[model samples]
Target: MVGSLVNSSLVGCDFSSSPTSRKPIVLAHGARRGDVVALSSIEALPTLAAFGEWLRKPGPWVGGFDFPFGLPRELVEHLGWPLEWQACMAHYAGLSRDEIREIFRAFCDGRPAGGKFAHRAFDRRAGSSPSMKWVNPPVAWMLHAAVPLLLAAGVDLPGLRPGDPARVALEAYPGLLARELIGRRSYKSDDRARQTPDRLIARKDLLARLETGQTRLALRLKLTHPQRDALVDDASGDRIDAVLCLVQAAWAEREGPPGWGLPPDLDPLEGWIVSA
Candidate 1:
């Protein structure tokens, strides 16, 4: 906590590429009351259109969104893309997914085994997936799909774009918070059958830690019994991730005047993850 967050609402979103009912985007909504940050509601957006509409809604909110904000500078420069953020994004959006894959694959092919993916500075600090990783997490595609919408929505992304100051958006990674709570413990699995007892226990422990104010962000989380159960019961981890991001948003709201908790030395081209 760096400042008074007496007047802001918080949101955390766990995003998916092709969101369906089975894999909808989870949006966790929360607000601070005294020392406790209470999770008030959750919204599921089943389509990109729905998500776009939700984002454009008026608000004085600080949202922590789980997606890479920019490509690795090395990758961008190597491909001779424009250095300007908006221009680079425009160029990126114009390319087909297959074209992106081919370009990234060629870049990886010449690199060493452990260095196949180029990383942003914030990724190094936060232990985030490489923004260029197209498969596995497919953050590259997520960035491609989400950034344009964010731009269109005109929400302010600190160090990236200037939009509506009231609706502030920050890059957030729930894994960073999860790792702090339980190092290398697997708390989620997309496979239905693999959602085991151990992961459930981990989720419980994480929720406990959050409620007790055990992280760098010094605010306690307040959840109703049903809200706690809902977060634990969903073994896919999207719900918990959204909550984690919501807490991160709360942290950001109090972290600084206008940087959204990002470091002052942050790279303009490579956005910083909130609370990283």
Candidate 2:
């Protein structure tokens, strides 16, 4: 079980070359709770080893980390990569960027029928998962970045045993909420100029929905103006990703605390839950 004292936290991370480590910096919202002003830390990484240490300590957190945790097995298998997780990771780690691209390109070529060569879900509607075979969701990358550290730190997933529960991580898809509120019209923005008033209005409306727990997942959360603005200010939607994590954390708290329904032997590196 997680401690009675729970932290409602959201962390938005831009991933780096070292999968398990974080860089390009990490921005944590709600780390201290009580309505936050800005993300806690953001910085470039000098080394993967250092980034690994930082990833685990980013908080007392029930976080929504913005990243994909699973890859389409089709793509992996097609690449003639190892079927097993460990072997696949080793293969991936050893390859250069060009090798990965060439391999991925070949796999995508002459792909299967069924409008599903790449997997991505823009909308959260029923069976909306686009496909799993995407190389970029880099769910494989997500796994490489996360799971090992959690296992070493003694965190457990849904399938784990009691002795193995400490930290908790969930694969949270921010697009879940984005798609829910705005459908598939591209709510993600990186250009400050693109942070148009229309998008801000959309985010405001979305926040209202989250506050009311107005969706299938039944998540109710409170957000201060500062929190709301912080999200709105981030043109890249990173802040909103953290907010999505906040909603997930809120729902998880309602069910139990840190250690509820988590699986054993689940990959910490690869985490997934509702897109929201």
Best by TM-score: 1
Query: Residue-wise lDDT of candidate 1 within 42-147, one digit each (tens)?
Result: 9999988888898899888889999999988889899999998889999998998999999999999999999999999878779999999999999999898888
Expressed as tens digits, the lDDT of each residue in 89-134 for candidate 2 is 5566676655665665666566666643554332233232433333
Residue 34, model 1: lDDT of 61
Number of the predicted model whose lDDT against the real structure is largest: 1
Cα deviation at 222, candidate 2, in Å, is 1.5
lDDT of 1: 0.89
Clashes of each: 0, 18
Q: What would the TM-scores of all predictions be?
A: 0.97, 0.67
Model 2 Cα displacement at 155 (Å)? Answer: 4.2
lDDT of 2 at 210: 66
Off by over 4 Å in 2: 1-26, 29-51, 58-60, 112-164, 256-271
